[model samples]
Every structure is written in structure tokens, then in C-alpha cells.
Target: MNLALLFGEDFVSAEQAVLTGRRLAHLKSVLKVAEGSVVPVGLVNGDIGTGHVLQLTDTQATLQVELPEPPPSPLPLTMVLAMPRPKMFRRVLQTCATLGVKDIWLINSYKVEKSFWQTPWLSEENLRENMVLGLEQARDTLMPRVHIRKLFKPFVEDELPALLKNTHALVAHPGTGTPCPVHINAPATLCIGPEGGFIPYEVEKLVEAGCEAVHLGRRILRVETAVPVLVSRLFDACS
Candidate 1:
């Protein structure tokens, strides 16, 4: 896992415990780590450490370990996106994690098909599967929290402010006041609309909510691609 690599430790060990989805497959088909092998280890949110391969058998693999330091500071931005199509959602989640975004708020929108909401991909197990894949890709141990808001206005006008108290906020809209800033300096919460895009009323409410309307370009970018592209661009600006 990249988080382990990023932290320089294995995620599981003796005394304390952790669960791994692919441990069996990893031991068998993936790493083929043998007994007595020293694998770097760390806890998801705790500390980076080392896990000694105590035993490796078909039943299971156990690790003897040592804990290390905590994980690094994460990206300062939180993304607010209109829930996209099923296939694109997986990519978006993975991209966000790969880029160190740990807080994602996926909400419903007018352009979002009603049928899309019922997808099995939103199930807890499926959501975690995608999130873990993203974490594994990033080599980051910290898992970003994902939230869903079905009703748009209430989430925007009510709960959003408290959630965004300390962060700068921006909403990506086409034909906005100014092109999206090349890079943003402070911590921010960015909201991006669904493919067909946010209607005038939605943009107005976001503006009233204190979000600066920023456009990435003259043309619109699909949500899945736009989310990562915008986040990466902002990461560079802030870094």
C-alpha cells in the first residue's frame, strides 16, 4: 500500500490488529512474501511501522511489528461534486485519493439521472473498495471521508457553511466572472457540477453561499476529468 510506503511501514502486526482484503491473494499471487520476510507496515490512521512475516500459509499470514510516526499532512482542499455516472465515479474517487484529497462530498443535481442514484456502487462495501484502491494507489494510509447530500439547497445553504467555516470556497461554472485562478493559495472547498452543468439558479445560490464562480476554460470539462484536473492545478498553485 502506498500509505505504508509513504509512512514507511506495514499496516498490520502482532499485539494490535487490522484487516486486509487482499492479504491472502497478496501472499499467494501478489508479493509472495514468505515467512521471516520483513515487510514495511503501518496503521491506516495511526503510525508507520514494520511487520515481520511471522508465518505465511494458505490459511493466513501474520506479521510481527513495530510502529512508527504518524502520516503526513493531507491536501487542504475538499471537493464538492455532483454525483457523476457509475464508471466515471470510480475514476474520480481514485484520482482524488491519488492526488491526496481525503474529503469528498458527492451530491445530487438536476442533470444527474435519477436512475443513477440507485447504483450498487454507492454501497458501503463498494465505496470502500474504490476508496481503498485510491489509497493503495496514493501510498497514503489516511482514508478520506466521503459524504452524500441528496437535497441540494439545504445542504448548500444550511450545513455547508459550518462544514466550510475555515476554508475558502469556489464553484466551477462555465462563463463565470473570471477564469479559474491558475493556482489557489489558501485551503478551499471546490464544487463542480454534473456533466450537463449547474443551472443559473444553482450558480446563484452558490454565489450567495460565498463561493466564487470560477471557470476553468471557455469550454466545459466532464466532471470526472475536471475534478482531478482542477484539483491538480490547484495543488500546484497552493504548493
Candidate 2:
């Protein structure tokens, strides 16, 4: 973990916080921090700063926290994604977070397996955990918002229009004529499909909802690979 992400529960007082579990293990094994050492720390949905270790032990560590710097600016992008395979879902979610995608929509697609939604990684706790891993990797603290929509048609017809408002909307399809735009660096909504890509009817629905069908060349990238590539291509300042 690059930054120790502190939740509200980690705080004992305004300026003091405690670390345990994975973070404590990281401190002991990875950082090898002493009681007097300072480590990079950030509060969830708050700011980035440093924590001076006041006490250290095998189980926990206490630190004096000071947060004055704002986290990196979130990407003005809304990601509408087809639910990926259970095995890849966690990694995709983490990638989205690491790319600074604050708005994420995990919607159903024709190729998406129904069982994909049953994965434990979709649970609130697991989602937060994976996103935390991503945030800590990026040294970012702002938590991303994930919206789940299991019904594809209803989501496209009812919700997606408003979601795409005032944004450059595009859907990444494999064989589409339009290449995915680069360095737009403005508000955008991007839709990506499952392994085999979205069916024609689903693509039509998304297109009807304001997304322009676009492609990332002839290569068919996996959902996990495509997410970061497309995000970086569209935005200039992810870091």
C-alpha cells in the first residue's frame, strides 16, 4: 500500500489515529517503520498527508495525523461497464478506481453471465476493500461511487440518458468505425462490454441513449485491459 487509508473509525481524536490489520502488517513487514518514523497517510474521501508514528507494536500502531493536501482531482468520466467475469471483476473495479473514475455503472449486457453478479466481490465490503487497494495504490483518498444496474434495457432507456448529460458519451465496441478519441480531457461517459462485446441490439440501445459507438483499433481487449487503456486515452491527467 502506498498510502495508509484511514477511515473514520481509525481516528481516536482529531489528530490521532490507529492502524491495524493489513495496514499494520504493511507497516511492520513492508515499511519496517519505527515508533518515531513518519509514513504517508490519507483519510478516506479526505486529504493526503503524513502520520508520525507515536507508538508501534505487533498488533497496532498509533500515529499523530495531519492532513493538509487535497487528493488528486477525480476524472470527469462516468464508466458504464458490462459486468465482467467473477474472476476479473475485482481487478477491473480496482483499475477503475486507480484511474480516478469517480462514477462507475456496472450494468448487464447480453454476453454477461448472470452468475457474474453473484460474485462476493460485488458485496459492499468487498467492493470497498478492492477500491481501497486501488486508492492506496494511487495515493488517492476520494472514494468512487459504484452504481449497479442488472437490467440492461431499463438502465439504458431510463437512467443512462441523464447520466450522459453534458458529457461526451462513447461506447467502446471492437469493430466500430470511429476510433476512441484521445485527450478530450473533459467530461465523458464511456461504455464497455463483456468478453464477446455487446450485441447489436444492446449497442443500438446505448447509442440511442446518446453514446457514440467507438473502437480501440482492431484489437479486442479484455474488459480489464480495455478499461485503463480507454480511460488514459480519453483523459490527459489521470495522475
Candidate 3:
């Protein structure tokens, strides 16, 4: 973990926190931190700063925290993605958070398996865990919001239009006429399909809902691969 992400429960007082579990193990085995060592620390959805080790033991480590700096700026983007395979979901969500994507929508597509939503990774606890991993990797503290929509048409017809308001909306689809724009660096809403890409009807619905269909060249990419490429191409805000 690049940064120790502390939750409200991890704090004992305004400036003190006790680390246990994975964090304590990381300090012991990976960092080999001793008393008086200062480590990078940040509170979840709060600030980025440092923590001075006040005590270190086998079970727990106490730190005096100083949160003086704000976290990195988030990307002005909202990601609307078709649900991917269970095995790849956690990695994709973490990657999105790491890339500074603050709003994510996991919607159903024709190619998406019904069993995909059954994955434990979609649970609130598991989602937060994976997001925390991503935040730590990026040294960011702002938590990303994940919205799940199992019914595709209702989401597209009812919700997506308002979500696209005042934003450059695009759907990444292979074989499309328009190439994906680069470095728009403004608020945008991007919709990506599953492994096989969205079916014609679904693409039509999204386009009708305000997204301009665009392509990322002839080579079709996996959802995980396309996420980073698309986000980077659309924005340069990520550090």
C-alpha cells in the first residue's frame, strides 16, 4: 500500500490512530518501520498527509497524524460500463479508482451473464475494500461512487439522460466512424461495452440517450484494458 488509508473507526482522537490487521503487517514485513518513523498516511475521503509512529508492536502501531494537504484532484468524468466477468470485476473497479474516476455505473448488457451480478465483489463491503486498494495505490483519498443498474433499458431510458447533462457523452464501440477524442479535459460521460461489445439495439439505446458512438481503432480491447486507455485519452488529470 502506497498510503495507509484510515477510516473514521481507525482514529482514536483527531490526530491519533491505531493501525492493525493488514496495515500493521505491511509496516512490519514490508516497511520494517520502527518507532519514530514517519509514513505516508491519509484518511478515507478526507486529506493526504503523514503520520509519525508513536509506538510499534507485534499487534498494533500507533501514529500521530497530521492532515495538512488535500488529496489529488479527481477526473471530471463519469464511467458507464457494462458489467464484466466476475473474475475481472475487482481489478477493473480498482483500476478505475486508481485512474481518478469518481463516478462509475455498472449496467447490464445483452452479452453480460446473469451470473455476473452474483459475484461477492459487488457487495458493499467488498466494493469498498477494492476501492480502498485502488485509492492506496494512487495515493488518493476521495472515494469513487459505484452505481449498479441490473436493468439496462430502464437505466438508459430513465437515468442516463440526466447523467449526461452538460457533459461530452461518448460510447466506445469498435467499427464506429468516429475516433475517440483525445484530451478533451472537460466533464465527460463515457459508456463502454462488455467483452464482445454492446449489441446493436443497446448501442442504439445509448446513442438515443445522448452518447455519440466512437471507436478506439480496429483492435477490440477488453473492458479492463479499454478503461485506462479511454480515460487517459479523454483526460490528462490523473497523476
Candidate 4:
């Protein structure tokens, strides 16, 4: 963890906060902080700053915090993703957060397994935990929002059009003729598919909803690898 992320519950007063659990372990083991040591800290959805350790112990640490600097600007991108395999979902969530993607929609695709949605990682607590890790890694405090949509057709037909409004919309398909645009540096909505890619009918629906089908060359990448590659390609700020 690069920055210790503080939640509302961590605060005892306006300028004081307490750390425990994983963060305490990190302080003791990884950061090796002492009573007078100052560490980087940030409040969730708030600002980035530093915390001066006032007290340290095996179980908890008390710190005096000052938050004056705002977090990094969030990417003006809305990510519409096919539900990935349960094993890879956590990593993808972290990647999205680290890349500064503030809005994420996890929708169903033809190739997505129904069981993927059953993963515990999708739970609110687990989701927050993974996103927190990502935020800490990036030294960012603004939390990303994740929207779940299990029905593909309804999402595409009823919701996606509105979501794509005033944004450059594209779907990343493997064999599409158009290369994914680079450095657009503007608001965009990007759709990515599951392991085998979206079925033709699903792609057609997304196309009808306003997304231009685009590809990332001939090389096939796993969802985890493709997400960062596509985000970096689309936004120079991320690179």
C-alpha cells in the first residue's frame, strides 16, 4: 500500500485518525513506522496528505492527519465490461481503479459464465477492499463506482445509449477493422468482452446503441491484460 486510505470510521476527531487491521500490519511490517514517523495518507473520496504517527502499538496506531491536496483527476471514461472469470475479477477491478476509471459497468455477455457473477469478490465489501488496494497503489483517494448489469440485451437496448451520451463510444472486438483510437483525451465509453469475445448479435446490439467496434491489433489478450492496454491506448493521461 503506497498511501494509507482512511475511511470515515478511522477518524476520531477532525485531525486525528486511528489505524488498525491490514493498515496496522503494513505500518509495523512493511512501512516500519515509529512513533514520530510520518506516512502518506488519504481519505476515501477526499484528499491526499500525510499522517504523523502520534502513538504506535502492536494492534493500532494513532496519527495526526492533514489533507490539503486533492486526489488525482479521474479519467473521463466509462468502462462497460463483460463479467470476467471469478479468478480474474478482482485483478480487473484493481486495474480499473489504478487507471483512474471512476465509472465501471459490469454487464453480461454471451461468453460470460453465469457462475462468474456468483463470485464473492462481487460482494460490496470485497469490491471495496480490492478497489481500496488499487487506490492505495495509485496514491489516489477518489473511489470508483461499479454498476452491475446481468442482462445483456436489456442493458444494451435500455441503458447503454443514455450512458454513452456526449462521449466517444467504442467496443473492443478482436477482429474489427478499426484500430482503437489513441490519446483521444476526452470522455469515452469503452466496452470489452469476455474470453472468446462478444457474440455477433451482442456486438450488433452494442453497435446499435452507439459504440463503434474497434480492435487492438491481431494479438489476443486476456481480459486482465487487455483492460490496461486498451485504457492506455485510449487515454494518454493513463500512459
Which 10 residues in a row give candidate 4 its minimum summed lDDT?
Answer: 230-239
Model 2 vs truth, CA RMSD: 0.8
- Any runs in candidate 4 off by more than 4 Å, and if so which? none
Q: Give lDDT tens digits, candidate 1, residues 106-129.
A: 887888888777888888888877
Q: Provide C-alpha RMSD values for all models, in order.
A: 3.5, 0.8, 0.9, 1.0
State how far residue 28 of model 4 sits from its true place (Å).
Answer: 1.1
Candidate 1 is scored at a TM of 0.85
How high is each candidate's TM-score?
A: 0.85, 0.98, 0.98, 0.98
* Order of quality (lDDT): 3, 4, 2, 1
Give one digit per residue, the lDDT tens place, for model 3 in 100-128: 99999999999999999999999999999
User: Least accurate stretch of 10 residues (summed lDDT) in model 1?
Assistant: 2-11
**Model 2: residues with Cα > 4 Å off, grouped in runs:** none
Clash count list over all predictions: 13, 0, 0, 0
List candidate 1 segments past 4 Å from native.
Answer: 3-21, 237-239
lDDT of 2 by residue, 11-115 (tens): 999999999999999998999999999999999999999999999988899999999999999999999999999879899999888879999999999899989
The ten-residue window of minimal lDDT in model 3 covers: 230-239
